[model samples]
Structures are given as C-alpha cells and as structure tokens.
Target: MFPNQIGDFKHIINTELLKSGIYIVKIQNNTKTYSDKLIVIK
Candidate 1:
C-alpha cells in the first residue's frame, strides 16, 4: 500500500495494477479521523 503526505488530499491512482475489490481509505488529523470504503470495478 502507498501513503500520501501531500497537504492537498488529491491523488491519481493507476488502476492498471489494481484488481476489482473492496478498498479502505483512512484519513486522520489532530482533531478527527475519517474512514471510507471503496468498490472498484474493472
């Protein structure tokens, strides 16, 4: 898995190497934490 540390929370993912499945995204800050799930379709 790759982690991003950019100030702006924007990313470009190369789906070419990813298979269709369920993925989890977790984001955290000093005040709050967020989590989400993503479904990818090929």
Candidate 2:
C-alpha cells in the first residue's frame, strides 16, 4: 500500500529523517507503486 508520484514526498522525508539520524531501510517501487521504510536509532 503506497502512493504514486512520491518524488516530492520522498525528498521531504529524506531531508527530515537524515537530520534526525534515521536510516532508510528499503524502497520498493512496482510499476506506479512506491513504498519506503525508515529506521531510527538512538
């Protein structure tokens, strides 16, 4: 369950999460589908 055309949304999340010391687990894109997972370690 993901969204299409996630370029802008993905950019925003990447910027915010990177500053917060989060790691991007994986990104899945199937045709017009897109999904991503993030992890935060303290």
Candidate 3:
C-alpha cells in the first residue's frame, strides 16, 4: 500500500480480522473479473 493512502476508493478496510499474510482480492464487473494480491501485516 502507498503511504498516506487509505484505499483506491478512500474507504477503510477492516484489517483487524485479517492475519499477517497474502490475501486475494477479487472484483467482478459483469463479464469482467479483476484480481489483486492483498498483503496484510498485523
């Protein structure tokens, strides 16, 4: 993640329930699907 940046949409994500590891983020838009790796350090 970038410094001073909250999120792509400026929304806060609840990372308190996430463990320290790599995560998969999937975004689906109709017939399209976007995926990205989410790394959480906690």
Candidate 4:
C-alpha cells in the first residue's frame, strides 16, 4: 500500500491519517537516515 522510494514515503507520511495525535513509526534503510517527524494538522 506504500511506495518503495523515500520521496514517496514522505508524501504518504504527510497525507496519511493520525487522528489520535500519536504514531509509532519505523523506517528501514541502510544508505540514509531520517531523524524528523511530519505532522499533519487537519
């Protein structure tokens, strides 16, 4: 249900729902490191 590219993953993160105001996240990659969070306010 998600793309394999980092950019696409970022897009999903920005658009996906988190109505409870908290999310448990994980990222799997060896070549890059992501150390930030994307918050969507609706």
Give per-model TM-scores: 0.32, 0.33, 0.27, 0.27
Which candidate's TM-score is highest?
Answer: 2
Order by lDDT, highest first: 2, 1, 4, 3
Candidate 2: tens digits of C-alpha lDDT, residues 1-42: 334347544422455666778856444445544666767768
Which parts of model 2 are misplaced by more than 4 Å? 1-13, 23-32
Residue pairs of candidate 2 with colliding backbone atoms: none
Worst 10 residues of 1 by lDDT: 8-17
- Candidate 3 structure quality by residue, lDDT tens digits, 1-42: 523333442222335434445344444444655555465555
RMSD of each: 6.0, 8.2, 6.1, 5.7
The digit string of per-residue lDDT tens for model 4 on 1-42 reads 545467434322433445555433445456666545555444
Indicate the worst ten consecutive residues by lDDT in candidate 3.
Answer: 4-13
- State which candidate has the highest lDDT: 2
- Which residue pairs does candidate 1 place in steric collision? none
Error of 3 at 22 (Å): 4.5
